[model samples]
Target: MRTSAPAAVLFDMDGTLVDTEVLWWETAREVAAGLGHRLTDADAPEVVGRAVADTAAHLIGVTGATPPPSPPPPTTGPPRWRAPQPS
Candidate 1:
């Protein structure tokens, strides 16, 4: 028996394959610092696992960052992907 290719694949990156929670924490801290606020342990819960726009909005409300820019227009095509080849 053979299987067809999947139409899409999804991976949970934050705590599964890669430890990105620290990266997000540090990044939020850095951005808060740049905007004249120091992020604390209390702040981590709100910033973790949020979209960039949501994070930016939170920063604006807390640290006064300039409003986030509007997103760019969508492109006209299905996104391209490349499957890994067997080695």
Candidate 2:
């Protein structure tokens, strides 16, 4: 008889195998404070598991960064890539 390899492999990391949740929370708080927005425990749920870019965008909005320009009229071709705004 021959044995087959497993069909899938899952890795448990971060909060599952290691306790880095607090570290993440602290880092988020520091970043938010540096950006001039106070982060509270009440905001933890939303901040956790979010990408850095997403969080930065949120900070930009909260810190009164310039509003994005209105999109140009839609066209029929493939979408274009806009350069990321400076943080």
Best by TM-score: 1
Candidate 2 residue pairs that clash: none
By summed lDDT, the worst window of 10 consecutive residues in model 1 runs over 71-80
Residue-by-residue lDDT tens digits, candidate 1, 3-83:
977766876665888889889989999989998999888877788887675667777888876774785344336756577
Local accuracy of candidate 2 as per-residue lDDT tens digits, 31-58: 7787677888677766676655555566
- Which numbered prediction scores highest in lDDT against the true structure? 1
Q: Which lDDT value does model 1 have at 83? A: 75
lDDT of candidate 1 vs native?
0.77
TM-score of every model versus the real structure: 0.64, 0.48
Candidate 2 Cα errors over 4 Å, as ranges: 1-13, 65-87
* Alpha carbon lDDT at 66, candidate 2: 53
**Number of backbone collisions per candidate:** 0, 0
